[model samples]
Target: MKTLPILLSCWLLLSSCGNNSQPAADTAATTTPDKPAPAKAASKPTILFFGNSITAGLGVDPEQAFPALVGQKIDSAGLGYMVVNAGLSGETTAGGRSRVGWVLRKPVAVFVLELGGNDGLRGLPLTDTRRNLQAIIDTVRQLSPQAKIVLAGMQIPPNLGADYAAQFKQLYGELAQKNKLTLIPFLLEGVGGVAKFNQRDGIHPTPEGHRLVARTVWAVLQPLLRQPMAQAQ
Candidate 1:
């Protein structure tokens, strides 16, 4: 009984120790640092127009070239795409084949391939043309599987032997079929052989003829551009 006070003091001390030693639950709100809003995806699809002088806007005034006209159409139609012309004057499939590797480095959405005209003009071998064009398609596919390809077919001048001309014209169709690609049969269409449509040389097109070419290109391209997978991300 006399030690009762001592026991009570020990009990109090233990109670105080327990209170001090017990861990309190943390109630602080933990939140992820407010992340910056994700960047908006680019609205404009990028189309790489890879070809020869036709794409380069060569021989025509800058504004009157086929690529420029195509750009205007894209803008007017509100397709939300930009066209990049990598065309060079007097370029052949062999040259294009050599250059295409470097060309693939760009962020290309789709390729508007208008090669083979110079090849035919220079009387290059059919095998060389086929190899070069096929290589282009293959390279594009390898680099960008989602890329849509539109091959603009060019006919050999009839002055070339009939057999060779036939083979050259047939090549475009065959490539289109084999690769499941889109074809703009006879890129010049209404303008190729016409006097009013061509330049004085009768080989290249005049400004009016380029406009028609752009219109023809647009007719085929607009449909593909409308397709969902055809646009770049």
Candidate 2:
């Protein structure tokens, strides 16, 4: 213990001679911590177009699609918002249900629901179709409680049987009324039977057809837009 203390004293003496003292931090300074991600810009209110090929504007200029048209109108009106096209070609109501969450991550203020056309084309059962669509609406309302819903209806060709078509079209009305939402009676209003209005595939709409669909959808949309965000029921 005596030898250890002598060695420590010699080490201290050598250290002092070598001037190895620790430096003091400057106290007259301010520390600026990193800024928090700039708040992600608080994002402009978003419009989510969650539909299938029709909404995706397949086989047409992407910028000229109906959703794009709606966005253009909203922009021109200075709504201070952005639109998200979540449309996937060949999507069904069930598919919409499956991906609803991923789309909702955006700051969506309004939702344009246009699915089930493929389901109608594929001649899916009405019960299954209705269930899927209902699930999607329920999921979306849960995500954005105050978000407005504009459900677009699709019609099946007569060859598919009137019974099936009746059930299919009826589903939209029932769901819309039940959910307290606005309904665009038929998405393919003027384009369903007109070859000039649809593409060669006779499924997706032509550019002009899309414009018509936008006009039809907009009729329901116009009144909704008049409702202030705070007063929207």
Candidate 3:
């Protein structure tokens, strides 16, 4: 009951936020004819984080976003990967499907799929969400065959109905299994539903919450980065 109101309020806030602000630019790399070859060679492979407000670091400085924090971790570990945060506040799986092509203009080594939360919060049709997500995944495979996909699982509060909540939570695992993607059991794990971890929004995480999110992601991502391609798959 209370959780439903919280999710509803979050959806409304995110919708308003989306209208007021533009989503962050897709930080994918581009090359020009005049670009120096050595500079190109020095460039690191990209790890693209594609998702919604949570990934966009809404209500916080861009640097405090989990993707950026992950970039910091990568640097500290001396991993040769660049993070491109392609998070769009209020984005749904359908929106992600529509825009993912532009985001994939540049090649990426890893693609972290983080959409669908907004879909669940809005009580949209689960079938549509699943279809759109599968489409996005198919597009990624078509365009970036070598990229490792990391699916970020999400859960909706039971206010929508226990069955809907159960299905929503189960969708991520289903998608991951169907596509053989590396999965993050629940992106918000320790932060979700925790009053201290969320901002006034009671939706988006605080800076400290992002740190916890970054850690959760890193636990799965770190090993992938360290493993050989054949083994990682």
What's the candidate order when arranged by decreasing TM-score? 3, 2, 1
Q: Give residue 16's lDDT in candidate 3 (0 to 100).
A: 42
Report the number of the highest-TM-score candidate: 3
Regions of model 1 farther than 4 Å from truth: 1-43, 229-233
Best by lDDT: 3
For model 3, which pairs clash? none
Candidate 3: segments with Cα more than 4 A from true spot: 1-42, 229-233
TM-score of each: 0.79, 0.79, 0.82
Model 2, 41-102: lDDT tens digits are 12345567789999888998766678877766665666654556678888988888998876
Candidate 2: the clashing residue pairs are none
Q: Predicted candidate 2: what Cα RMSD to the true structure?
A: 20.1
Task: Tell me each candidate's RMSD, in Å, in order.
Answer: 24.3, 20.1, 10.4
Query: Judged by TM-score relative to the true structure, which candidate is superior, 1 or 3?
Result: 3
Q: In candidate 3, what are the lDDT values of residues 66-143, reduced to their tens digit?
A: 988888788788876666778889999999999998777665688999999999999999999999999999999998
2 versus 3: better lDDT goes to: 3
Model 2, runs deviating above 4 Å:
1-42
lDDT of 3 at 205: 99
